[model samples]
Target: MEKSPTTHVEYDSSNAHSNGGDAITRVPTQGKDAVVGTVRLLLGNETVLLPTPSPDPKDPLNLPAWRKWSILILISVFGCSCVILASGLGPIFSVIRADYPGQELKANDLMVYPTLFMGIGNVLAMPITAVIGRRPIILLSMVTLVVSSIWCQHSGSLGSHIAGRNVMALAAGQSEALLPMMIQEIFFLHERGRKLAWFVFLENFLVGIFFFTSNYMVSAWGWRGWYAFFAAFNGLILLFSIFLLLETLFIRPDDASTGQVHLTLNDVGKVDEEGANELVFRVTTKDKDFLEPEKYGVRTWRTDLRLWRKIDNWAQVSYFYLDFLKGIVHPIFFWLLLLNGAYLGLYIYQASTFATILMSPPFSFKFNSLGYVQGAQILCCLVFLPLLGYAGDHLIRFLSKRNGGVYKPEYRLPSLALPAIAGVIGAFMYGQTAAHPEKYHWLGVALNYNIIFFAFLGANQVALTYAVDSFPLKAGPLLVVVCAGRGFISFGIGYAVLPSIQAIGYDGSMNVVGTICAVLAVAAIPMYYFGPTFRKLGQNYYGFGASKEHANGGSGH
Candidate 1:
């Protein structure tokens, strides 16, 4: 007979029946009683408890709350600064154009190539990080960012400027992939959504601030001033990272003795003993801290700041390569890549086109005034940050309770609804305003931009949380996919936006893009309904949850 979803079988070698190890036994348990005698495999909710942490003091999960948040805050600053450098160039394109008037490269192309390189650079940088550790790679990337910024400041031609930006993109790739992994390393599943929200908020807030500020910097001191400012800013972050950031790549072995249990056929009132049989029982227990207490005399500050820490020579480069390939081919990951790419493309399209639209004909917004307009996005993000971050975390807890404590990744999907609606309205209004700026007031455009940004930020947080929760073991490779896919898509859209506007007129282009956004946003429906089945399929075919040994009685690893 086929086993039910709630049924699992465990073979007990120590208490096997004496039939020369050939015969088998059967056990049956029902309802709440089914989980009582088995090794507490699942939590009170039917969700599998994944990769139970070791009882080691130095385990990342064992760290104090304040310590974890401190590291997260520092990393967030580093990530936010990288995003500013990547995007700050967009608003100052006019200044760049004025300087290199006769060159073949347009200001938009400068934006396009660097964005593309950021994605490509992630592919190259992530595997090395997996081997060398997150801290060293991040420090190296910061140093590269500072060096590249200096190059951009000194560049006299379009070629040299683009070259400098591309080099920066190569270094900035670390933040895109590393930040999410850092969150996964430190926080529990329940805390991930809220933490991810904070990370996403920092990124959006910085993007808005820099884009707004770039206009003023360009108008006041010229574009070189922008590069100088970023170089100094990144240098400070590098110093902080060197002194404060600890290496989070500690390996904790699964402890089967404390972590697992065995049950017999007679334990649950059902027994069929032909000779030797497998009895599988599940026990549920309250969550407890598995980390050991920190040692009193150890000096962690010296250890954290060590520049030449030993690399993991045992890390197989080929294994990471295969993992990356697997992430690329994974069905759910592929879907996430498309969704992330499209959302980023839409946001970049709006931002890249914003200054051009308002600086012309009807509005003729002064360079200094661009900050106020972009401030609309910042305002919306700030408003929704709590709603999306804190509320979304609680929503998952509530939904999990409703489902009898069996948390499926699909719980993350419902939060996407409000964002989808916002996107549709924002796209339509922005498109209409752009098509007829004289007909609709500029406030209409600003309001629509606010709505779109709010939705986009929310969607990003939800989607990323879902991705990490669904495949925590593969977080590194999965983020690589997300970074690369989103980068290429954003580049394509940024490159095409000007020509598209000229060809279709602003209204037609916006309508087309809006429709696509709506479709993509609604795509979550099928995922919500079918996600459990898809996860099961992945488990069967590719061993998706194999790394989560705690969930399966600490045997797989």
Candidate 2:
């Protein structure tokens, strides 16, 4: 009996020769077309034409730029609001403690548990979002957030507060993963980096804004007033989302028979019947039943009002779960997961330790003054985010043009350098200042905090963009690993940070964490050099190629 042919085209490095090496070799597979896309060399870098947008005007990719931005901005706001509720609690832990006198409500119990659950919830939420639709899950998550906020505001005991916070965290996790996946769905390859930066900016900046204001809100009406404000704010966002957000999920087709075709750079050499270069190739249908919607129509009041409508693709639950697990184990995904986890853990440690340092002897900041420090970090983000976003997108464009219009995911890795250097400098300054608070002015500490925030934002935007560029088809599942891994790891580190700081003074703790962050940031160096090889390996081993749905004009959702 003969062995079955592999689905992927293998590129064996050992078999290269002087004459244009066999970078891609196709093997015949039964029931599928033999015309696999070609991977060409452009300026010594591997390149291929990405999947073209479907002709259907209703396809998310084919939507007008203005319309896409509108939707993205709304989603960003909703997501940012959810994140603010989660992180803003850190600044108000004292108020909460005072509210429930004699109750054992540690930050770990109230804040860390919710943080951990936010990640844990994604394991359940993402697979559902993958099956159901993005719009439904988002709206539902917002409703849950609203209710949880209300419950938290009325909590009379430690257990009730923990439960409410856990629910709220679960709701927030939906946005954390879904926003990036939505960006991948709506934006083109060249556009994702900057858009991701916008998403990160909104989340981090809003967290600062909310934290800054919570001080006043608590002072004016007490801690419950803070939860009430969140409840009202979340409720408004939920209403706005229902009316404004439309379902971005579409079923794209794979074959040319239904007016869709997949293409490769190799086809640039072939001619069509009209004598033009046949740059696009046609593939057979992998799933003929999947069809693109006719129009990219905006959701009406009636459509949006149907809160309980069943999503059509819910039967793919098993596949969604399996895909998420498989992505977690893939080398590229694993590397990104670890990198994200380390960076987030370090940031969380900084936030947790910041409160301890400022609330202590040298600079006994009043309740109102507690949030002013974050203002500097927010300002820092405001200045650097746009520049970094522009630089990241421009870097890829410049490198692609330099390499003869061929773009590789590794091009994004250089942006990592800014964050790596900034993190080291910021950590040293922050640690030294914190070690001798009386010697170094508080403003210097604030400047170091801003530096760290700037680096964190830059690193996050680059990593997310790189992940999507590397595996556009598998983005949904890949994000599950990124979001969940970061959430859990950060929670663990956050829980321990206070204790660690107590054990070893500020300088010792900062040195340990800063060293870890610097090391992880530097790993991007090796990734930039070897990333393409890993992508090729994933293609062969995990079918990292564009899915039939994505290639054939079906939704990659």
Model 1 C-alpha RMSD vs. true structure (Å) is 7.7
Clashing pairs in 2: 58-296, 251-554, 251-555, 252-553, 252-554, 252-555, 253-552, 253-553, 253-554, 254-552
Query: Which residue runs of candidate 2 sit more than 4 Å off their true CA positions?
Result: 1-51, 101-105, 253-315, 546-557
Clashes of each: 6, 10
Residues 487-551 of candidate 2 have per-residue lDDT tens digits of 88878878887687779877887788788888877788888888877887766777655553332
Worst 10 residues of 1 by lDDT: 16-25
Error of 2 at 107 (Å): 3.9
Q: Report lDDT (CA) for all predictions.
A: 0.66, 0.66
Output the TM-score of candidate 2: 0.82
